[model samples]
Structure formats: structure tokens, C-alpha cells
Target: MTTFDLIIIGGGPAGYVGAIRAGQLGMKTAVIEKASMGGMCLNWGCIPSKAFIESAKLFKKVADAKSFGIDGIDKKALKFNWKKAAQRKDRIVMRLVKGVEYLMKKNGVEVINGEAKILDKEHVQVGETKYTCDKMLIATGSRPLRVEYKGIDQSKIMEIDGFFALEEKPECVLVDGGRINACEMALMLRYTGSKVTMVTESDSLIPFLDEEIRKFVMDKIKKAGITVYTKSEITKDAEDGVYVGDNFVECDVILNAKRRRAVLPEMGDLELEMNGHFLKINEYMQTSVPNVYAAGDVTKQFFAQVASAQARTAVNHMNDIKETLDYDKLPVNIYTDPEIAYVGFTEEQLKQKGIDYKVGKFPLSVNGKAMIEGETEGFVKVLSETKYGEVMGVHIVAADATDMIAEAVMAMRLESTVDELARVVHAHPTTSETFMEASYVAADRPVHI
Candidate 1:
């Protein structure tokens, strides 16, 4: 048996990050991972998808390269090499995995490769070996929630994991879900020359997005020639394709893009309180059991950024540091063709909370940089308190909206008012100017609206 100061179960974003922080605080830490160190986000989910998105975006750009002053460029000469793209994605994933391994070594954190079974709050077993720690963090993460229906065969249906392993791109695909992944896959497949149809049980795609932004994205999706069925379900799985509701749509493949649930590892005789499938954690990410904490997808907020923050907060709480996470200022993003990002409360959320707020919006159509790049398709919207003009939320939908949201997140974090944000001069002919303009509108003195 071996003992340490902390033993983290699972080496994904949450587990590995927590291990590094614990080790840096002079606590001996060991991370137990059953598979690759970076887990789903690196190996299968985020990194690989972004790599594919970049390739698809380049293809789309080249199709319009002639308008970009490249007079002699032939759009017909362009062809996508899936094998090459796959290889590049794999290389990027491996390099990052190696970098994480290096960090683990540098921080004096041990990496163990095996499934961990928690014997108790402080004791865990991996195979025939036993280990003990002063505290345990169950960061086992989550798996895709499988849906079952009549005539549905689990062997035939392709989940995200199986979707990544697809060698040949389908001629027609039916993407099922209304979440970020579904929107991304639908756009990526459509841009990659596939006939894509999206079906969702929600009223619209990305139901969590701001109402206006969701409608704008839906319009874009329609303009892309991809069929969509909302407030529907796949009632039958036919031989040629699936029947979404009563409509039989012909497609070569069905991509299930449903929700995910916390994957609880084997914990013998240690009953932890659960909120559905997730292990409930407090503001500091401490579990119901003493000395046992949980973070990441295991606690409901299923983003890498949220997971990493929770991991750090858990470690800080363990070290007797009085620090907690604030989810209100947490930024969220979707990496579709026209990326979507937001920080702080949405207008709907503020209304529900009975907070009187004012809204200001600036369309990219009026921005000089957006016109130059031929990427003017969205807007930057700011929501602020009516009385104080304090920035409450910022929602963006544009090509670089994800990158631009960091400034908004900082403003919300510092409790900056719209007047302050408006007074700060932004450089000329930039997408960031749209944000400044929106702030001015929020402060009630509109400029270039």
C-alpha cells in the first residue's frame, strides 16, 4: 500500500488540474487515470472538433476566395483531405497530452494508469494495489447520455465517440440534439459538403442562447440549406434512415448528440449524496461526505473552464484558503460557424430574477473591420442595470465572438459600469469597437448603433 496527501480519481481537466495545484501547495499528489491523461475534451471532444472546424472554415473561405481579391484562384481546384486533417488533429492532441504529462512531472504529481475504486472516503483501490490520502477528489467526469426508442439499435447508432472514428464522410446525416455539439456538428458537416438535417426536442437550436441570438442562428442554419425539425423526436429507426416524428428522412448516418451525465466510478460501501446522476458539490466543490470533493462535469456545470475553476477552488479550500467560485461571471461559448459567447446573466435570466436591466446592441454590419473581412453576420449586445448602468451581461454572435468575450468577462468580474466601458477608447476599424459602441448605447448615449 502507498499513501499520499491527495489522490484524484480520473485525470481529465478537473482531476489533472487539481493534482497540479495540490502538488504546488507542497502536498504530495497522485492522479489515477484509466485511459489517456487529457480525457474526452482533449482526445475526442473539444480539440479534435475545433481542428475539424478550422479545416471546414478554411474550405468555406476558399470557396469565397475570389471575392477576397484573389482573382486567379480557382474554387474548383480545392479538395479536402480528411486523412491529412485527421492526422493533424491527432498530432495536436498528442502534443498537448505530452505537455500535460510534463506539467504533472514538473509539479511532482504521480500519474497512475488504472481504474480507481474508492474503498472509503480516504482509501482507494486500483487493481490489487491500495492507496490512501488525506483527501480524495472524484473528478471522473461524464459520458454521453444514451437515448432509447422503439426500433433503435445501440450498435448502429453513432454517438460522439463513434462519430469521431468515422473514416468516410456520410453523404447525408441526421444530427439529433439542440446543444452546442449538435449545432457545431450540423454546421461542420454542412460546410464539409454533407447533406445535414438537424432534429431536436427543444423548441429551437441552442435553446439556452439569448432568444434573438438563437433566432439569428436558426436563420443562418436555414440559409445553409440544412433542414431542421424542432420539438420533435426520432420515432422509428428505418433501414434507409430515421423517421423524425412522422416524417421519414433519408440519410446515410444518424449522429446522436444528446446530453451527458456524471460517470460515477466504483465506490464500494461509500454512499455519496447524488443529485440525479451527478455527485452534488458545494460552492467550494466539496461533496456531501467529508474530505471527499467533486468537480467538473460531475457536478452539473459541464464545461472545461468551469471544471478547471472548480478544481482550483476545491484545492484552495483544502489548503484552508478562503476562496470560492462565482458562476454568475462565468463565460460560456459555442464554436459554430458564427461563434456565440456570453458572460453574466442573460436578459431572460435577469427578468426572472426581477432585476431591472437595459439592453444595448451594435450590429457587425456597421463595423468597418467586419465589412473588410466580409464576415458581418452578427452583433454585440450588452445588458446593464437600469439605475446604475452596471454591465450585467454581454452576448455576442460573430466570427470572433468567442475571442472577444474575454473583455466582457473581465468587465463583469470587476463590476464595471456601462459608462466606464463606453469611455474606454477602442482602436479604429476593429471588431472590438462594436463592443464599445454597444456599451455607449447601454449608457444611453448611442454612437454608431
Candidate 2:
């Protein structure tokens, strides 16, 4: 098609999702992708990393299986097959990529493959073909940042793609970065028997994490035997080991966590207002130019979930359907050992805003399901406003923390109070029951400590 009602640039979660919604609303949509479909999250970043985590968790389970009555698990005999795990990760990534392609076809959206150059607001040129659309969406996500050091073997430094390309795990691995991917990778490799050491330039490990959750994760990773050093510097002597602030760490490979900036391609003379490195957008996801909208990593929000929602909301606005996302209620999930997920305000944030809040905490060590599964090492903390009893935030650290955080998201979406959640009958003996119990504690009536 030479023309479309809407043309979306970059076929990641943002562009593809917007295309589907636009098609459903009877808009002639076309999505132009320069690289693979499903973006970085589905293809390499999120999906593959989670698959690795699953494998790593299995190793931990096998090591601890003696208590669960699984006999004959010889610790010396157990070995993790890196090739098989990579094969599985690749399989899962491919399946989802195909699914995205299928969705594009089913939704009556044309998928064009090539680098998109925005000729203007109404025109996008991919090679020689100049397609025009009434409105355009910029969903092009970020590119990974490269960190360089004066070293003897620069070949050892690997990005996400490079590390995934390895046939097997490397001995004496030095992990770099302090984000979700870096933390997950360190733990995964440690479980798989790599001598892993982590060093990051950030002041705090996973700076965005809730303080309590951060402390718990720090303790867990230390106990897991992954050496961590923050605010690190690569000191002198390029021959042997890299000194991370005097703690010399020698390794065969350096795996970097994916740190990225909003990387936009050349777009002729079009200028986009920048919010730091990302595009500035309105509440409806519209850019400075009314007809040109942006979402995903190209904009302020980074989470795939936020990007998808922003794109859909932008599509709704284009169709004259006025709707906007709840910015404060957006959930941030981190795939650490066990897991960390939370939505709304952190205690620090609440305190900073001078909001009167009460906290309710329920430890998984006391939960029946957790005790039965022998994964009783986390807790759920609920924070609510004292005056109206409205839920301010919900933080969880558990095997199913990401899954359980959804209920809190829904409650916050509906503006449901803690009293309401406390009153609702949740199925007993599940980790989610902690939510109600935590709410009870917040209400000053604790059934279980």
C-alpha cells in the first residue's frame, strides 16, 4: 500500500500493538520495522533472560531437593548444559516472534521490513518507496550503551547479544551493570557454577528498587556467592586483573547488563523535543507535532507494558476516544532471584511527598504455601494512606511476586481501598493471601505476623 491511515515506525511492542488497535478501529495501518519483530524485549532482552532464570532456578531446586525427599541428587554429578539451555531460550524467542507476525496479519496490518526514514510527518521512506500516512508513530526503541576500559583483552567484554552467542558458560566471569538484566545474569551464572563477580558504577545496586527489597536482594545475592562491588572503578595495570576499587577481579569474560539510551534514527530535518534522551510526549502520547506521536523506549517510559499501553492510548486519541493511562500506578517488575515487583509510591516517595501512610508487612516464612514449597524467604509489604485507607503501593519479594502484583495493580486502577481488599475473600494457603494479611496489618488488626 502506498498510503495508510496510520504508519508506525519500529515494529516492537509499541508499534505492533498500536497497529493492531488501529486496525480493530477500522484504520488502515502499516508498521515498518528495520530489524526483527517483537523488539528487544521479546527477542533477546526479556524473554531469553527469563528463560535463563528458569533454568538457573531449576538448578537451585535440584541442589535443595534433599529436603523435599528427592533422593540421589549427587551435587558433584550435577552439571548445567549451556548449549541445551541456549537452544531452549532461542526456541521460546522464535515462537513469540512468529506469534507477533501472525498477529500483524490477523489484524489486517501491513508489515514492511526495512529501516524507516521519516521524510516528514506525513511521509516515511524505506529505500525508494515513499509511503504516506495521515498520522505517524515513532516507536523506535533504544540501543545498548557500550562501556570501554583500558584492558589487555577487550575481546572478553560482551554485550547481551555477544554473551547469548556463547556455546557454553565462561569460567571466572566478571558481570558489569547494576540493572535488572545484570543482576539476573550474575545469579544465573553463579547457579550454573561460574565464578561470577559483579561490578557497577551506580551508587546503589538496582537504584529504583524499594529500599527494603534492595537490602533483601543484596543479602540473597551475597549468600548466593556472587561477589558484588558498586561505585567501582577500573584501576591501573592492564596486564592481569581489573581492580574494582582495589578489589582485583580476574575473569575470562565480562558480561554487561543492557544499559540503553533513546536511540532515534536519522529523520531528515524533523526535530523532536527531548525529555533527556527520550522524546517528550503529552498525556495522550502526542509529540510536539500533533500528528506525530511516540511510544516505547523512544519516549520517556521504558517498560514494555507501559509502551504497549501508551501506543494503544495514542491510537484511541487518534480515533477521538479520549483515554489516558494512570502514570503513577504503572508497575515496575524486576526479575531477580525469587522476584521483585511493585506499583505506586515507595516509602521514600511517600515520605518525600509528606503523605501520611501506614505499612503492613507479611513474611512468606509464615505463609502455608511458601512453607510447603520450601521457598519461604520473602515478604509482602502494603502501604496505604491512613486517612482514606487507599492503597499507596504494594511491594513483594517472592517466587511469584510478579504474578501477585497484578491484583494490587487492579485494585489501584479501580481506586480500591485496603479495607476493600482486606474484606474480599482470597483463596487460602496461597502466597497472594499475603496481600490480605498485609492489608490487615496496615489496618492495625494482624491475623498473622
What is the TM-score of each predicted model, taking all chains together? 0.98, 0.96
Counting clashing residue pairs in each candidate, in order, gives: 0, 0
Task: Give candidate 2 misplaced runs (Cα > 4 Å).
Answer: 150-152
Q: Which candidate number has the best TM-score?
A: 1
lDDT against the true structure, per candidate, is 0.89, 0.87
Candidate 1 per-residue lDDT, tens place, 133-156, comes to: 999998988888977756865555
Candidate 2 clashing pairs, residues 3+ apart or interchain: none
Candidate 1, TM-score vs. the true structure? Answer: 0.98
- lDDT by residue (303-346, candidate 2, tens digit) is 89999999999999999999999978988888887888999999
* Model 2 worst lDDT run, 10 consecutive residues: 233-242
Q: What is the alpha-carbon lDDT of model 2 when measured against the actual structure? A: 0.87
